[model samples]
Target: MSRESITPNGLNPDRETIQLGKLTVPRLFIGLWQLSSTGWGTTSVTRVRREMRRHVEAGYNAFADHYGTAEQIFGGFRSTLPDPKVVVGATKWCVFAQIDITRSVVQAAINERKEKMAYDRVDLLQFHWQDYSDRQYMDALEYLQEFKNSGDITELGLVNFDAARTDEICTQFPGLIVSNQVQFSLIDTRPLDGMGDVCNKHGIKLLTYGTLCGGFLSEKWLGEPQPDEYGGPMTPSQRKYLDVILGAWGTWPLFQSLLQTLQAIGGRHGHRSISNIATRWILDHDFVGCVLVGSRLGLTEHIDDNDRAYGFRLTPEDNAEIEKVLEKSKGRELVRVLGDCGAEYRRGGGHE
Candidate 1:
């Protein structure tokens, strides 16, 4: 499709677009981790497929998935869409198991992911290593680079990788890595400390998640009482982010204050929702290439609110309002406690 005719109905005019190798994707990607059914909640295949089609129709051409059943689920959904080639898919290869880092093993893994996703090639293949102590991940990347050169993968990306390690990888490989997926939000700004600079220096972009803090940053939780117990009717994401809010972010009262501030700012901008303001804040960051928004598929819909993020820009006064509250918050110290962008998962704590 020509660039002029590529715009979809209801697409926000101000939404930025970026080029990932040869694939051009919107600044916001539809996240499919919730489709795994292990964390968010139970999802029906029909509902998930319908939601996927809706996102693509809305011009959210790029989608993110993981190794497990997410790729398969996305594959099934993609089959139902018209001209699936227009939709860009991204999946990860988890390097947790100890396996021989041979070229054959790596090629087989890549082939398996492609076959499972019903695609000859993936737009982006992101690598996630649970234990950085192991050196097998480097070998895996070496093999992936070969595939990238041969056109099996369009781009290579990393998940939860720190600044120092990312720089080392870039230095050793030159221009192999194009992007890094990390958690970046109002509550978690660890990426700004070092990762941002390294990515900027090396021409690596960032795809950020957890910007909404698993719905904790939404209007639904504003002024609401904190849950007394950890487990209840809350989804796993909600339970996990709640911990960050209480632990890293600070007291519920302070969070409520932040929420009100966002609401007021959003009100000035066509009465946007809290989630819209939160997502727009992340998109405003220079290092961020895209913000991954978790979709519950047919379970719920936020297409309209999400589109609002691109409708208006935040002013300096608005940023100052958020900063004023953050100044008194413990988010900075929380970054230290959490270690780095993907440190929580590596250390087996925090929300992964």
Candidate 2:
């Protein structure tokens, strides 16, 4: 579809957005979870700044990050954008509260992060509860809630909360949570096991990661051996997760067939890649405010290709064809085998 004929659903949707409380963010937000980390490359601040300029020029307004240095990366150059409108950012606090998450300590961190990011307030500070057993969870939530209520944060939410626990939190603090980040993607539909319906009922939207399954669902991985050889001596989180999906989806040959079907339909739509099809398929699944597609900073930029997803919408026939392929192979039941959509943190005791 031509840009002239298509309607943009987001900022440029050439970027994208969703309602995070009162704040609107790009539909396809730039994820910085791996940025500033060495696994991908030596991220130079200069290069990262340039990437942000290009990304903003493309219309993507949100950046989600986790590590301490993440704030530093975006914080270093706060005045480069167009009137603080280029990007709306979100970062996570890994739920490692020390005994009591003293308000002074929490406020100090927020101030530091806010000052570094060059914003009066953070658009969102995602709360990550590593373990439900920790008593500090309450203290942390209290302070986080205080921040949200006082407008230090545009909004506050959780990452990877189980359905049961999510219900408990909402009951404890009514009408406060605007969203929850989860692992919703082609391979992980675990949230649909009643969580999404409940979210709709209670007014919470879901921000999903792994939507592309670490490139496994793309054309490149369709017919390959699933890369059991592991990219290096130290396996990556995404690669390992893809390996598991491959196991669940049967073998490489079956996945290849699935990819081919997507390719055929995608080709019909001028996309020619399964990744675009997979992304479009999720847009209307309900309660999905947006999907988190990561940025490798220096590795690759798919911003232009990602824009393809917005110009078109999938059809019933399109979904049926995709499902037919999915039926042939095993679907993602890893959440069942592992736990709820994001119950991995509690089970594995946080990321390795």
Candidate 3:
């Protein structure tokens, strides 16, 4: 576990893989949400496949939360591997509208994913429900369970579901669900409220995203002035998380203080980058399973910097110092202000 002992293809196995049902996945997952749209920029399929190989060789073999042509592109890359099972791929079936939750409807969703991925069964199928009032998500989940029973899916998970519903659904289907994907970061401490306890009670693992706040939680933005949301080089993710930073979490000045604190903590940990410290803070929690880092693939990459996230743990002094800045902000009050983990999406703040 020492920093000097860590290798490129080797990492702390315990920290590298977390239990996700019967399968073990890397602690860090490569998120393909950027591939869902051109807002993050575009690249050739050849470069993307090359980047996927680089990630695998670098010890990150799990991928998730893709959309549009992401699944198909991932399918092509996965086929090139010697053994396809060497990688873990997760796809989503999001219901943003009110529709009948039929068995065939569920089958068709899975079928399309499988056909796109060129696999007979999906490695992981995450479900997202937009409207909580409809309650048909339960029906969809029930049918998803039926698919699992028939071996159409190896694992079932939730995307942007609140803690209350996560607890309820897990109780209704005991020992069925494996993971719940949610937004968890230093600024957005909503998961720390009730979601942590719910995950513990149900034996569920949290696949967390926005751990770096859409690349805002880094040294690049440490002392920089807040950019205008209307005119800037900010990506879609940056725009979304910027609202959380300046609007919900705290003022721009307070966030700068946090970044400084993180910088200091990173200095204590042998000058690890702010992103490493931020990700380490989340991975340190026992309830968390993986931190999903969004990568623009061919356009850009942080594989080496991100790889440094492992082989280090935050000390009590480090956390205490980080919390000093957090106390001045609205960090702990996010759950009350924004409801639960997925309230940002449900409350019309747009998706994470």
Per-residue lDDT over 1-352 for candidate 3, one digit per residue giving the tens place of the 0 to 100 score: 1111212375445347787997788899999989988999999998997888788878888998667688998988887765788888988988887799899999999999999997889999999999989999989989999999999999999998888999999999998889999999998988999999999999999999989999999999988998899887889889989999988899999989989988888988888999999999999998999999999989999988987798889999998998889999988888888889888778884654
Window of ten residues with lowest summed lDDT in model 3: 1-10
Tens digits of per-residue lDDT, candidate 2, 129-225, equal 7767876776777887888778788888788887877777877877778878888765667887877876887788888878887666687766656
- Candidate 2 vs candidate 3: which has greater TM-score? 3
Error at 269, model 3, angstroms: 1.1
Model 1 ranges off by over 4 Å: 1-7, 349-352
Mind giving the per-residue lDDT tens digits that candidate 1 earns over 183-254?
A: 998888899888999988988889998889888889998878887645367876777788898877788898
Give the clashing pairs for model 2: 16-26, 16-27, 17-25, 17-26, 17-27, 75-116
Candidate 1 vs 3: which has more lDDT: 3
TM-score of each: 0.93, 0.88, 0.95
The residue-level lDDT of candidate 1 at 87 comes to 84
**What ranking of all candidate models by lDDT puts the best one first?**
3, 1, 2
What's the TM for model 2? Answer: 0.88
Instruction: Name model 2 segments beyond 4 Å from true.
Output: 1-16, 231-237
lDDT (C-alpha) at residue 217 in model 2: 69
Q: Which of the numbered candidates is closest to the native, going by highest TM-score? A: 3
